[model samples]
Target chain A: MLKIDELEKCYRNKEKRSIFHTTKSKEEKKALDGINIDLKEGQALACIGENGAGKSTLIKCALGILSPTSGSVRLFGEDPRRNKKYCMQKVGVVFGQKTNLWIDIPVIESYKAVKQIYKVDNDTFKRNYEMVMELLELKDIIDVPARRLSLGQRMRADIGLVLLHGPELLFMDEPTLGLDINVKYTIRKFLRQLNQQEKTSIFLTSHDLDDIDEICDDAIVISKGKQIYSGKLDELKNVYADKHIIKISGMKTGNILSLFPGVELTEKENQSIISWDKSCYSVQDVISGVFRMYAVDDIEVREPDIDEVVSRIFTEGVSI
Target chain B: MKNFWTYLKISIKSKLYYRTSFILNMISPIIVLCGQVLLWKGIFKLNNASDFADMSRNAMFSYILIAFVLNNSLNWSTENSLSKDIRNGTVVSKMIRPTTFLSQNIADMFGGVLIQGLFYTLLVIVIFFIAAKDLFVPSFSNLLLFVLSAILGMILRLMINDFFSLLCFFVTGYLGIAWLKNAITNFFSGAMIPITLFPVTLKSIAGYLPFKYMIQVPISFFLGEYTFADGIKTYTVQILWILFFIILHCLIYRKIRINLVIAGG
Candidate 1:
């Protein structure tokens, strides 16, 4: 549903101002460097990037908020910049830090205003409004003014207002930033349900890895404005899932450590924890070899999570 | 158009949200009205001149009241809010919305004027009528002319203010630009003193600027200074200046979008 081709955005340096003289000096800094992406309909993708990796810039360009210095973004089949109104009609955006709702007004009033702005049909508005309020749990706080809402409540209202129009696609930029763990889980759960039940496509950018792990199946990892990885989250897991630890419960006299002297092993609480690079040893090897040598009471294999996978990708500066 | 009306309703609602602030808002204008009236009354008294700049003592009193209301009605500051939105990056929300930026902001101004300006204007009119009953009744013909001129003047002022607000896209701090705009409007638009009372060169300079149409020409019509032909000429010139500012706004908006620098991510 969305295609970004060779997208590059450069910001011009501000002019130097002085009383005596003004100079025509221009310096350009590229925010996005040749970003290429393709998102199919109903596919939720997480855009993983560092703080200055031009994630927001890429989203703004796709949304037609800021014109790209070069390249083009197409929503459905039309360029958003050329067909802005039509493009915006099919998309919902939630800016986590900045509010989309009107301040000094009740949260529900802002939702109603969004209804007018988007020209949402009554039926669609009602269905989405009820679903969003219930999922986001915006029941008691709907009457309160937006300025008085807590960070989580306001973010909920922001997301709900955009969803009120029943957009086909949602672009959320750091939707869980500054939210408490409980609030964060609530938002993630709301998004997961919205994607699963509604078949709504989501393009999410976040620093929180768990959000990506829960809501998105595909991920595009960028660092320093370059797209390094674009593939299935499971594929990244496979590539970065080199660290595997197996814990075996045994008495102190098992002498398992002496057998696997070449491998790294540690013990605690009557358990022999054997750690090794998955490239060096397999789970079958551990079961066949470690079990026979030691008094293996229990075996537990630990696979690395998405967060660890992403941390390794960034640390190693690996590109796909 | 539907969006415009909706925003107008919300704008008016926002204006009325702070009750204590509105009370204080009303008091400041009344104080300014009192001070300007007394100062003009003292000046006319000391000079022993029945008329200044072809305006009689009664005309000046009525003019001050009318000018005060007109100025208050146009007090919506597009710069302050627009700059805040830009700095905070919430303006990104506006960029993503279906409506253009100009339409949204104009709707916001209409909201501020219709709701906030309505009650204050009504109160000031009642007080003026009680204090100067004899001068409150302008001929219906004059009232019609004043109303038409005022509407055009408002559009012209909105164009001007929108122009300044767009400058916030380029400049870091809008305080200097905002103060400069207020200063120019107060002096050149004759909100502080009648344009006719100015020396010849300054009057000629004001004649060429759009700020004059925003206040001076409209007030001149209210004080019976403009005949039908004069009214026609004044509106023609004001319309031309309005067109000029519209073009200027378009040009500046294009440049701003090209260099669109939203402060926060």
Candidate 2:
């Protein structure tokens, strides 16, 4: 539903000038560099990278909030820049920190405003308002002013505002960030359900691995404004699947060190965490041998988190 | 039209959401009006002409009261708000909306004017009527001219304000410029006093300038000072300004948005 071709964006440093303002600085920051991406209809894509990854910049380009320095973005065969109104109707975007609803307005009133902005009819307004409020579990607080609600409550309302028009493409930037576990889970669940039931295409950028695991079918990793990886989330996981974390308590550091070869040791007094590359040795063999060598009080082994894998790809340059 | 009403209702609800702040906003205007009334009354007494060389003390008092209400109601603050919106990222949401950003802004402005202007101006007019009974009531024809000129004046004022606001997308910190524009406009526009009281040069200069049409011309038309021909000529000037600024607003909007997008590049 979204296609970007050879997109490049460079931001000029207007604030930086030569002495006496007679000269302009040629210095510029590349926010997006020759990136090509396509998001299929009804597919949920997750964008993961460290800070300054240009994830937000890329999304803004797609949304026509920022024009690419070169190339172009097309949403369903129309230029988003020229056809903002039509494109906006087809897409819903929620910036992580900004709530679209006015803080002093009640949730319902804000929804009404959105409804009018999108020209939703009375019947649709009622239906969408009811459905969104129920799905977001915001029935009780829908009449309350947005400023009076907690962050989580406001976020749900923000999502509700986005969905009022039943947009086919949803660009969610860390929608679950800073939410409590229950709210996070609820949002993740809602996202999954929305995508599956409505065939909504979602472009999500989040730091939450759990959100990615719960909702994304495809994942794209970018580093320094360049795409590093793009494919199935599991495939990307497999590519970075060499290491397994083994947390061991009641094992002496020296003894644990002796048990495994090529194991990266993380020690803390009586506790030690071992990162064993499965490529060098099977995690099973390493853990079993460690269990036999030390008097093990407790041990837990799990795959490396998606965040760690993605961060490694972003910061460690996909070499290690 | 539905969007307009929806925006109006939402704005009102938003304003009322902070009940304390809403109360304060309403009270601040009233307090400022009271101060203006007191100062104007003081000036009248010190002028030592209860009859004021043809303009009665009662007429001047009512004129001051209405002038205060009109100045408060007619002036627009959207320039500062628009500047802040640009500085912050709130304009992004408005950009995403199906409506044109300019239309959305105009609706918001009208909403504020409708609610705050109507409420506050009504209060001021009621108080003026009760406090000063025999100031001046225009003939029906003059009343008609007054209302027409006032409407035209309001449109001109908003156009000017919105035009300045569109400049925010160009300059850094245009709020200061917007404020200075407002102060200068209000001072020369005779929103505080009729232009007739000014020096001959200023009065003549004010006669030709569009600023006078914003307050003095309209109120003077109400006072039956302007002949029909004179009223039409003044209104034609206000309309010309309205058209000029409307075009200016559109041109600036396109230029600014393009520049902003390019700069973002």
TM-score of each: 0.93, 0.83
Judging by DockQ against the true structure, name the best candidate.
1
lDDT of 1 by residue, B1-265 (tens): 8888888777777767777876676677778888998899899999899887787888888778777877777553433576567667777877788887777877877676675457766876786668765354567788789888988898888778878877777777877778888899888988888888899999899887889887788877877778788888888887888888888887876666566867767
Q: lDDT by residue for model 1 over A76-136, one digit each (tens)?
A: 7898877888989899998787888888789888888888989999999999889988888
Write one digit per residue (lDDT tens) for candidate 2, span B15-94. 55566765566677667767876886787779866776567777676677667666776334433565666666566677
Per-residue lDDT of model 2, residues A1-320, tens digit only = 89988888786656545467676665788777878879999999998877778887888789876667898899878988789889998899987667788777778778877877888878877887787878899988898988899999989999999999889999998898799999998899999999998899999999888899889989888778877777889888878876778888885634555666668888797677888776777777887777776677988886567877776776667753
Model 1: interface root-mean-square deviation in Å: 1.3
Q: Model 1: what TM-score?
A: 0.93
